[model samples]
Target: MEPPPPPPRWFQRLDRRLRLSPLGVAWTSGREMELMHRAMGFAALGFLTLVPVLVLVAAAQPSSGHGFARWLGQAIGVTHESQLQVERLFGVPNTALQRTTAFGLAALAVFGLTFGSAVQTGYEKVWDLPTARWHTMWRHVVFLALLVGALLGFVNTPAPSGDVTGPLTVVVLDLIGTFLFFWIAQHILLGGRVRWIALLPGAVATTLGLLGLRGFSQLVFSPLIASSAVTYGPFGTVLVVQSWLVGVGFVVYGGALVGRLAHEGRVFRRLKDQDET
Candidate 1:
């Protein structure tokens, strides 16, 4: 077949303009990953599997009397009224622990492994690595254990609402904790195929994204929870929570995608220049 004709000047200019910018590069990469769809999948799998496991983790914590519901409320930055609604959803920690059984825990763990697998797969795609083998289930297990631990730490950390330093303290702690978790998580899930330096940008990006999401949740979901509960009862509240999960998924994957482009410095180069290099 004959080679395709060179692009028109206008077309070339438009392409060059987009490909040379970081935002444009992000847009392109996001489309390739079907980023929104991937985020939805992350949210769906995380909700169905990881939430149950986290509930158990919350139940197991002696310090947290309010249980998984409290964790959920804090994560989404809700106010006291909204947090109360959430506590009602899951009941108290003792109640949650009372309901737990060996068989039930095992089942939740098995399902939670799938959530870890999904996270691993997301990392692989971001790095363009081949899928890890079935034997790699051990990594998933470890990842899940660490995840539970990280969350437990978050749940247990006390940030008194009335303290002047409470908000600042939480911000600093969240930044450090989130950074370490994602940086280590990428190493673990990628099986260390990627170097720490190359993965650093992704972790930073993901952490910033999470922080931004937390801020947004505080402004939006905090009030939404109270109102939604009144309008649609528990189901409305559930919808708001699900929406937050979707945002979380979007940030986790989208941030990594942004970081990959940044690492390559492709965001600084035009498409034709990149091709030549």
Candidate 2:
């Protein structure tokens, strides 16, 4: 019989390094980096499509006009200058705004379908599962509803006034809310196949990573936004938003990989038990 083909050089190196650390074992065993690479394209596409829809929705709410802008600025680590540029670009007469909203909403509905489908495809790939058929419309609707609700909650929360504790409090609440949102997304997108216990690690990791990204953005991307604004005008905000979404896509894929690894480990244990019996 022919000898088994030798392992890839990269895998061999990975294995050698992975053996030195338990966490590395879990991470490499799931091949999360590989999965992240595959899922990122779809995730980025979903974000690109979804962002315009969010802008439209925020524009439609006149009473909370500045609220959305402020939230967007905070989310992307941009300054008020960037937010002002956004408002100026989108500003128009009421009649024009109404027409724009109508057209934008229609376009968003179509794009939302694409976004949902892309997210489902990513989940299916990570879990090594067949495509899900049931509750397609329901799932998409629920997903959008959850997202809108989360945004509203974040924007409506009162901003910190004076106390040092206030900012920290907001951050903690935001982290918890983000964790819950990610957890629900995993459960819903995976068709409820993954258990809650197995999903927690990935959800937490993703949430913390996202929170870290938010902090990192201020130090890194803020200057980029400022320069782009000077050179490119209002469209600079769009560039920053796109870059932020790409980071989000990578985080989403990483979280899914973590959850998948935990689920597979559990399955392997059960099979080993059965074989021993």
Candidate 3:
């Protein structure tokens, strides 16, 4: 009997489906996970840098919430009376949740942009490719950074009158921006020529991840909220540092997973074809 040809490299291991064509699959299957890791890492890193800047911003205007307040008044065309009412409800950096949320939100975007670049590089590695030049990869990141920054601004901003309009606007804008960012990032990292329709999977995955993480955080960290406030003390600092490390690790693994799945799906169908032949 004639010997069968050796299996293709993309199908070298029939059982190891996860290791097949990891680069190709990662562009689709694992992109959202990579983005999640990037976002979390950036937010954590941002917190490290932003706390100090916020302290400085706070010190500069200790007497009033003027910096943020003015930003609000101008952004949404609200009257001073409406702004003051919000200020009273949310208070200033001295002791307001808004202050923490503001710094947190800003850090999230800044650091997310930083870490996202690294995640894309990891994606490139799984594709057995050299890292893309900054020129090639940067415009996408810059666009995402601006888009996310604007969303964060809206999320952190206090409502003009505690009405639904402002918060609703922020939510709608954030969701739309997030979906667009996903589409663009995938295009850049995967070098895929795709339309926005191709991004539906990414959008759905991201929304699911966000919701899942929200629930996980609420369940896992809820106890800490009441027991002791977590801060940047040594222990909390270690935890934050570890989370970023873990996030980076996940990005790499996610890239590989994506590549493998894409490779496998293709190879499996090819193998079935050969058997039929």
Candidate 4:
């Protein structure tokens, strides 16, 4: 019986030039979510807090093939040359275990828990949920454990061959695994307040974004790694890796944002939701 109200004047003018009603909502949402800032936070916390724990877990596993470096390589899909650079950047597993002390191990675990909390906070923000109670710390512990197990399992996923089935199988398995991970992650991290169906779009979007990032890494960061290593040495390598991590952060939150937009039917309103802020 009624037409949709006209979009705000700002959107009306901008839409005329660029027809950006679709993308405009995303840009505005990114600002509202502090998306980039949260992503950078993810990169920093992931590297500083969680990585050491992962390095140890990867190295400690009796079956660890290439250790953490191998997992990192697969996670980001680096080129062969870039993979070598990453291997050199991190210490070997045995040496790490040898150098580690009980107190140090405890510290790493604590730091890992903190990293989980940071991610939980981000998820809460996405759903406009308030922070969970302190007693929920156990959820962080569980999430950290699952994350490590999942990553370790990922590195062990068999390499694909030249045959059609091999690649297809690998792709199918990856999609399933990654999807399950994010899907479960949201449920656990958000304390299960958000329904599984509500979280599905974010999980699927994140998985696709990761697949795209892997291809982009092969084309872009793979070369940048070689050059950065030559120009900036190990520090250069760190820079490239950090930049990649930022991309990961963007995708993680971006996917959830997209899911939220779809659920709320805010995909086309542009600035109309300004009051909702």
Query: Which tens-of-lDDT digit does each residue in 1-277 have in candidate 3?
Result: 9999988887756536654444444555455445565546555554454333444444445654555434433332334444443343223456434345665758655665565565565455444456666566565456455544544454355545577787677556655765565556655665553334443454445544443443553444333322322343334423533443354345334534443454556668889999999
Clash counts per candidate, in order, are: 0, 0, 10, 0
- Model 1 regions more than 4 Å off: 1-12, 266-277
Show model 2 residue runs off by greater than 4 Å.
1-15, 18-49, 79-97, 101-103, 262-277
Q: For residue 247, what is the lDDT in candidate 3?
A: 42
Indicate which candidate wins on TM-score.
1
Which model is ahead, 1 or 2, in terms of lDDT?
A: 1
Tell me how candidate 1 scores on lDDT: 0.83
Where model 4 places Cα greater than 4 Å from the true spot, the runs are 1-12, 15-20, 266-277
> Which RMSD values do the candidates have, in order?
4.5, 4.9, 11.2, 7.1
Q: Comparing 1 and 4 by TM-score, which wins? A: 1
Per-residue alpha-carbon lDDT of model 2 for 185-226, expressed as tens digits?
878777788778777877887897787788888777767777
Candidate 3 positional error at 91, Å: 9.7
Better of 3 and 4 by TM-score: 4
* Residue-level lDDT tens digits of model 1 in 83-175: 988887765455677888898878788777888898888878877889999988999989988888888777777755777888788878878
What ranking emerges by TM-score with the best candidate at the front?
1, 4, 2, 3
Question: Which residue pairs does candidate 4 place in steric collision?
Answer: none
Where does candidate 3 stray beyond 4 Å? 1-116, 125-129, 147-150, 153-174, 188-199, 228-277
Candidate 2 residue 167 C-alpha distance from true site, Å:
1.0
